[model samples]
Target chain A: MMAEQISIFIENKEGRLAEVTAILRDAQVNIRALSLADTTDFGVLRLIVNDNDKATAALKKEGFTVGKTQVLAVEVTDEPGGLNKVLDPLCEQDVNVEYMYAFANPQCKNAIMIFRFDDIDKAKEILAQKDIKVIDGKELSGL
Target chain B: MPIFDIDFETMPREGLEAIQLRRLQTTLERIYATVPFYKETYDKAGIKPTDIKSLDDLRRLPFTTKQDLRDNYPYAMFAVPMEQIVRIHASSGTTGKPTVVGYTKRDIATWAELMARSMSAAGATNGDIIHNAWGYGLFTGGLGAHYGAERLGASVIPVSGGNTKRQITIMQDFKPTILCGTPSYILHLAEVADEMGVDFKDLYFKSGIFGAEPWTEEMRQELEAKCNLKAVDIYGLSEVIGPGVSIECVEEQKGLHVFEDHFIVEVVDPDTLEPLPYGEPGELVFTSITKEAFPVIRYRTKDITSLNPTPCTCGRTHVRMNKPTGRTDDMLIIRGVNVFPSQIESVLMETREVAPHYQLEVDRIDNLDTLTVKVEIDETSFSDDIKGLQAMEAKLSHDIKEHLGVSARVALVEPKTIERSQGKAVRVIDNRKL
Candidate 1:
């Protein structure tokens, strides 16, 4: 589950995203989903890809600094307060989420929210105790 | 680790005086024949080449100033013909018109010989590989050390400054036994090495020759600790011969050796231009004895130091100069007291809290000039407490005032706020409009 998401450091400059994607494409690593948090000089490029190891290696070889991170792919219903349900239990346990981004699967009618927290094991445990649906790497990569 | 010249290093007064007289005669004849500037100046001074028969008579010549060089500009100062000129290097053009200096092929050869002496003095030899990180081009430092390494028959890697990652990559790949550049740049490379998780200690860099800007003994200790190498200070100006005029030998970092064979040095009061007694701090002056193209006669260097004629333990006979305390040109006059940025650097390094990155913002608050030092705190020391940070700022401010006898506003900033420099770090930002 943790092997699918990769947190890469992309210097915030013009055409940086396109450059990273091009590097991934040339290496034949298919991206499942991607999001970015940016500041003036640099940004965090969070990616979920089919071959996380290959994409990481390819980008790194191309001189991009990359790091691995485990994130929860929580299943949310396609309705109001869907993200709220997935987030409340973690918030109660004080498992603060640094950031999150979403992707919708058209065929399943379900939204997958990728969550990054300071403590991954604690977050996973809280979600498990609450019986909240935490999708595996196969499910997250497919969506 | 600045060592005096091998040949001149242990010579007695009589022997040294003999060498100076011979070099002086040759220098005078060369300047008279090829350099129009020296010819005109000599005629006006009513001093003939024959008149300079000894070291005592050499002092009768007039002093040269930076203003004289600026007045002449480009090639007017060249004693040799343009056909023989090989390269030129210049001082940083911050104050006004840059002070231009020229070199001939012979001059370059002499520079390499002297730099080779500096390297050999630091225990670098033919079996070593030398990595030069000083910036190239009009600046004499990078190429100065580069030529010296080449002259010593060492494998030279002309890694001319910046791109720290690439510098380390080359450091690891090349496995150089010797490193040469500014002390500040080496410390910066150490930081990069740390970030890359490369154990620089395990690498092959055995020694370094660091100079070009004024740094303190404390800094020398810090750099030596970080880079895990014997760091030596080299002293020279573009007007004289670049970085290898004199250097520190391995015995101690006490003072720089003056290449008295090629250049004559004197410490004079910046105001009166009178020679200071040995061990009294004053402005440093130089007269190039061996330079063919640009032989500066008693040029006022503006750097401050004391002369040590006492023989060093290093077994060389060349006179040593204490590390320059400050530059008369760069000295800051605040409320009738003088301050140098190196003094502040010493204070900052002593603090042990702030990263080396800092800038002094000097401005007039009402009628008085105010100094505000903004020091960048290391990222690892970051915390979310605003009040505690303010306390740190106050403590720094108080401590600096207590140590330096000047009050300043100190502020702790986030890491990387201060600009990272590839060459000389700009520590002072004076907005006094003067």
Candidate 2:
């Protein structure tokens, strides 16, 4: 079970982030979860959107350097150390998390955490054997 | 100031033209007799050596271009036999094969004499120590300046290029009066010296003869202020005769005086190839009248500058050529390295994931030339992963540097972002001039 994340290459200049948001707003695309990794010269804006194809076309039409990456969404108990419980098993299995972000599902009591693992298949298999629920792209896109 | 070779340097216009005509006739006869390329060229033009009666008739001959030299390759253009050739030098072609030049014993002597004249005109004397920093080897800038300094009886340090710190150390210890190199490199040395806490002004440098690349007057001001010396512009090319074809007399910084007795200088319309009168800027073309090994007739230098036919206050009656303002070709001299846009385009074409659409942005950052290549990334290879994109950029940059010998900052822009023209694509956005 994997989710597609759209990443845009953004130059580190004034009002650049605003420009990206404005483009998305004009295209009527909703960004679900977003994260930015930046260096001195430029930054990469990683985004999970409601519609991948539409968002990619709209952004590409507006001349943005965009790419797609695969990530995993897992449901965790909304309790103390919920992230720790899910991370401990992957860490024990020697799986590395490149990056991660969280969002609470309104319909469920559990919290949905998105993870970009070094090896998505291996991490999914390990988490599956440990009885942790992995949210697929179809379900995550709906949220 | 002592005028070097008073007879030729101070010769009247009529006397200079008389010597030029005689030398031009001999040079034409030798090239037409020895080099088959010149024979075919002259035959195609329906002209003979005897047809060049006066200096003005020299224009009837076809202009020799750098492409002609490259097409001939190694020694096809040399008028003298291998036994008579003593030295060989070349200009870095950057595109393909280098344009080669050869020198016989007399040709070497002529080069030394012209260089000596250039040195003396720039206020260098026998007691002065010459620090030659223009590169050596196949490039004529180094050895050309070296022999001239020696010919002038000046102590030569032959400090070719690079090793910035050591060059400064030698400069401080040797206390040289004459510094010979490109103006940009001399400024670079000044910065390095300042960083080392060595005051360049305290050095015994009295004057500098800088050339091998075109530099602005502002650069001369910077070099003189930083190094505490008079920065004189010296012009030359390997195809004509390296580093001493012409030089600016220190007494008058107006324009460089071409050694008319040895070289016939002309400024012509780059498009029509029609000769322009004095004081009108055009493509500079040179004809080597006295060279023995490679006597070129109407060699197109591709440099854009005018000739000052007026008399100079320095007493040198030789026709003065203005410092070359630009080039007729798309050649860019970045930090003394010759870089062509076509060369950069070839590098980009070979690399994967980069589109053919690209623009080269050249800027002068902190008194140094900086090249930035803005290339478009193909949509198929575009990825959201930061590390993968960075790896691609690094690979392209490394490949470009390997091919061009000069480092460039590779900037990946979105496809169709670079303005596409219906006509010829404007490849170079030179911000350096601004």
Candidate 3:
């Protein structure tokens, strides 16, 4: 499944995260999942919002350094082997994920996972060859 | 005394001019014989070494630019042989390749003497200890001041740059009466000194020489108040000798005095290259009369400043030049108009509501260029109302246009949203990829 991730370059300061949220809320966008990687001067705020296009447009209009990137969304069980099964194929293909986070889809019992890999197209090709079903942006937004 | 070793700082006008003419003749002959770049350029200009009989005749020669130095590469521009080069220093290459400059034994001695004169002009003496915090190695700022202090018979503490804790400890132990570094770093030092509860007033430092980046009088006042010391501006470039080309005297910090005896300075239109009258703002050009390894004539410095012929209150007969407002090379061309970040700083300082932390990002979308200024709001100006914030942004946008002659999109963020730099803060982020 394809996860639409919005990455933003944010100066490390108070209320910067809140400012992003406020802009998204004003544009009627909902953030489903989020993660943050920080450095001394700045941080990369990654988010999986319900409306990526609208969120991106609104943030850009307000002069925020926002970047849109495609990520992987895999559906796995909540058990121990669930993560290993999804990661084993990626590891075998020599695909390295920069970062990843998980969230359980409320509509289904399956866990919806997000990952940032070095080579997204290759990872997607390997998943397709393995008969892994991938969903679209519209399908994941409902969850 | 050898004319090169003559103390030009105290030389009379007629005597200095005569010395400059004689050195100019010798420099032309030497360069024409050795440096191919100079030889070709002088030949193209159709000027002979004998043509430079007076100070005015010096203009008939070709102007040397930083590009010429880069085009020559390595030591192509060095007039003297490799054996004579005692040292080399370079400018910070943030844009492209750094500009390289070399010094012979005599050139090094002249640099040390000028730096010593500059320090003495600023009231530093043999009895005073100096904490030279400017960076070392390739950077000329640290060693330029270091050699001067040593020549002045002062106890030199080469603290170099960074390591604020160690700098403060050494400052306390050494009791240095003079400091040298960029203005931004000095402010950072004062901040750390405050947080650490170090009483700066108790320190013996009486003055500081700041350069390597352009700063405003606002910054100078802020640094002075914070550090409890008088701040003086020192001007120079690796292209000409180093940090000792000119400095502020103790009696008045109005403008820096150029050591006109050893170095000749002239202001001319940056684009047309036409000589401008005194008191007009233009690019500063310099000719080194005493530099041996790398003697440059009519070197276009690209700094924008005006000249003051009036003698300084400090009693130095040398002519004074206004603090450079900005760089002609850094001027931004938006559509057809020219804009400078310092012009925007003037507008922001006048408003009294915006903090100095700001960045200008120029982007082109759909064949139209947009200037977006991200300014930080001071604590007193913070407002919760969306309407109030929008109104403030609109006001800033209008004011920027009125002052800088360019329409810009202004967005006021919370205090400290933009990054602060200890060195030179990148003011412009141009995204207009050609």
Q: Pick the candidate with the highest TM-score.
A: 2
Clashing pairs in 2: A67-B384
- Tens-digit lDDT string for candidate 2 (A50-100): 888988898888888788889998899998998888999999989999888
Candidate 3 residue-wise lDDT, B65-86, digit = tens? 8779988777899998999999
Off by over 4 Å in 3: A1-143, B1-7, B93-95, B331-434
In model 1, the runs with Cα more than 4 Å from the true position are A1-143, B1-8, B93-96, B331-434
Q: Rank the candidates by lDDT, best first.
A: 2, 3, 1
DockQ-superior candidate, 2 or 3: 2
lDDT of 2 by residue, B1-434 (tens): 89769999999999889999998998889888899999998899899999988888977999999889988999999998899999998766746456789999999999999999999999998999999998887878899999998899999999998899999999989889999987777888888899999997789999999987788888888898999999899999889998899999999987999999999999999999999999999999999999998888898988999999889999999999998988888888776667788888888777757777888888877666788888877667676666777887788789877866677988776567677679566788888751
As a TM-score, model 2 comes out at 0.91
Decide which is better by lDDT, 1 or 2. 2
* TM-score pick, better of 1 and 3: 3
Alpha carbon lDDT of each predicted model: 0.77, 0.86, 0.79
Query: Which residue pairs overlap in candidate 3's backbone?
Result: none
Residue B130 lDDT, candidate 2, scale 0-100: 96
Classified by CAPRI criteria, candidate 1 counts as incorrect
